[model samples]
Target: MAVPFSHRLDWSIATNRLAQALTLHRPQFDLTASNPTNAGIDYPAGLLNAFQDPRSLHYNPDPRGIESARAALNLGPHTLLAASTSEAYSWLFKLLCNPGDAILVPRPSYPLFEFLARLESVEVIQYSLRYAEGWWLDYDSLERQLTPNTRAILFVNPNNPTGNYLKIAELHRLAALCAGNNIALISDEVFADYPLTGDQTRATTLGDNGECLSFVLGGLSKTAGLPQMKAAWLTASGPGAGEAAKRLELIADTYLSVATPVQYALPTLLKHGAKIREQIQDRTRANLGTLQNSHLRPLRVEGGWYAIIPTPRTRGEEEWAIHLLENERTLTQPGYFYDFESDGWLVLSLLTPEADFAAGIAAIHRAFTA
Candidate 1:
């Protein structure tokens, strides 16, 4: 019999092997920063205090999740959380999709969606956010990728690595397209709290009078810098139009996967999210300052913790990264690792410790200059 593995599993298959090589080399200034706790920054003691709330002893499992957690989400400065993600996902699946449905996802973004789709048994068709005229969304490419199988579109606002947010106008266009085609909108806004500059507010998930169902995914990972806390949520919004709420409820019930303590502690944890977010934003701002002052030139990332630095004309990024590891003893991620369109790119974590970030940028400069 043939193997049961899916094609998505084959994507990025070599990352693990390359990552293993780095550990053996003991490179300094590891710039592949994703974990908040490992970045050498301290999360506040208030986080622990929030968790000690005695209310956790009671098992209050709401398929819609704790009302307070949803309330905290809705209270965002420029966005509102659709009441229950549990109901949202369930209804989202029902209202617009079925098994083997094709979901549109952004390219040059985080690769996690492929796995997420695979777990859901959904086929993902990636649309390029190809860098042209300064990293705008390739709407033309997106239109070309759509087919009868397409049931939803997924976006990472303030997209990872690329660091761009869905503009307000673009959000309207996306909603219009989805609404017209009876497609759902699934947005991963986990990085929304980290808008790089400007108004720092982008379009919200409220669709045109609920014509299109929208799901916003976020968590304490980037928002509160407490990934270990394992608190993530999907907020469902949009006019249910019909049956949207029912489907969402079923989805949440199937996977009452969240821990009881975490669910109970969510309200307090969310309350503390602001403090954690402030520290992270400050760190990102300072580190970005250091990078800007240095020799390397980074593509404008509107949000997210990483910067994609365009490499020098002569060298490919993997070669540069490998040389940096073996010689400069600095560790950084190659753009190819994140499926960049070309070879002349590198990704650096903005959340690295100040000294390490500074030194890593310096090493990157040295390597690029050489």
Candidate 2:
């Protein structure tokens, strides 16, 4: 018998050149990757100790996850990470939003948003994050595009490549706008823990006074260097948002997307965040110094695991990256790959091994000079 698949799955394209390189030369300097595990950071043994808990085999499915795990999330690094099991998905028809519902996304941000939105059968409307004033959101275009069919705005705090965090004032204004419009806020804050300038205190949680409904997504992928664990969470926060959460819970319950062992081990894994975070921050700081020493003028990154260097316009970023790969055997992500607004940009991993990072920056300087 033959089976038919939904059109939404069509959005799932095999990754492009980046994936091809990894497949071709798996051992090359992986400056293009943001994954901490591959960056050579040491994972603490406690991570394994946490997962070895045999109780995970009991098969308890709460849909919203175990209460203990949820509590740990709430009390952990980010204040908005908390949630009551009952408040877990609130909208029953979130699945019903259909393929045409418009969602706003930022330009010069992570490229995965397009594929993810397509998989959900949702249409993406792009808004520019202009660099004229240090990469601020172009709220003008965003406000103009707010149509009746617009469902939500997708934002990445400490956005990838750009590495700019949403300011507190901007966050409040954004939340109020969404609340007023009765639209939802989908925030991807995976880089929240890596702030370079400020101490690692939780930013204002999305749930303050519950004025606007918000879903902040985070995971062990970046936080604890446990991406292989395949655990991530979507926290819904708003006053009286229980109904919306109930609906989300239904979708999660139907899919049971989170793994049993990982869900059970969440608390212990979350506790280990401090150790992993320390190492990553140190590596990032060292890499930042290397970037500075190269005199290549990297964009100011308040926080995040990657950096974007402004190259000369004469040598296009794609050609520059390709040439560096061939000549220096150094792999780097071209700005075009990440939807950068213009030419002359290259992205590199801050979490790359210190020695490799140092050598790569030197290679980059040579690429630029020669």
Candidate 3:
């Protein structure tokens, strides 16, 4: 018999076939590129020199990571380091859940949660983030999804494709709900630093959340535009935070997945990494301006590195994506990929080069007008 693989390993998708086939032949302007390293942003000189610290030659393992690195984060004494945010999620899942328990995630957010939950034998229930003039959490829908076995609620602050931050009022309400139900809050604030609009009401971070047991996640990925560094962290706060951190420390001890060198270099990386973050902020803002100036008026993006463009409903989102790829040689992601409830929406990466973003915008305009 063939090896009995978990159902989570099933990775077939038919929707991408057309885009893959066309890209094989065409030199396309890929507007879906979000990786800063792959994008054309210039890095600071000798940024890698930070990794050469002599302290890295010695090995002293701490489950919470090196004192200096954790101190550099300033997330407080309850912080723990992980290899990446994905690993952090896995660790959190393991810490909080038993097999078959459920967690509430936000709809129209990144689709990675389901897979991550499934891998841990946990279920994912989605709450709504409906969009009108801007994205707002549907609190009623969220409360209804809560079951006796609901262990946590995971939300991406300034969420992935939707690009809306949790408002101050919203955060307080969510904290109260989680506290009432005895559930934890996982706030993924990886994209918190990249703001495209002036939204003073947005909740910048959940590190200080004191209403419930909260875990705030951030990393060099978006902080410094250094995803390759493989250093991410989670800070536990609110009630039971000390015990939670102790349990999380046990989990981190099992893997020790974060490298010693990265931990040693973190302070330096964070210091020099400010320049890269500035560059990314500038690039995303400039590209967002390019989109707003075009015929297409993208949705109001309060922050983050993505913009949602509502295309004409003359065709389905998949058809529109394929049309753009086939006719315009411009690649974009249909909103359905991120679980947008309706059709006729496309998501573009604001990290795309300005010239390519403008050209892609023109191609999109031409496609609709023609």
| Best-matching candidate per lDDT | 3
The TM-score of predicted model 3 comes to 0.97
- Each candidate's number of clashing pairs is 8, 14, 0
Worst 10 residues of 2 by lDDT: 84-93
Q: What are the RMSD figures for all models against the true structure?
A: 3.6, 4.1, 1.3
Q: Residue by residue across 20-114, what tens digits does model 3's lDDT show?
A: 75646473688898899999878878888888899888888998999999999988889998989999999999999999999999999988898
RMSD of 3: 1.3
Q: Looking at candidate 2, what is the lDDT of residue 336?
A: 87
lDDT of each: 0.73, 0.72, 0.90
> Which lDDT value does model 2 have at 355?
89
Q: Please give the distance, in angstroms, between residue 155's alpha carbon in candidate 1 and its true position after superposition.
A: 1.0
Considering every candidate listed, which one attains the maximal TM-score?
A: 3
Q: Judged by TM-score relative to the true structure, which candidate is superior, 1 or 3? A: 3
Weakest lDDT window of 10 consecutive positions for candidate 3: 18-27
TM-score of each: 0.88, 0.88, 0.97
Model 1 misplaced stretches (Cα beyond 4 Å): 1-17, 75-96, 199-211
Estimate, for each residue in 149-266, the C-alpha lDDT of model 2 and write its tens digit.
Answer: 8878778877887888777667777888888997888777778788877624324344443568777777777777777777666666774356656666667777665667777788
Quote the lDDT for 85 in model 2: 15
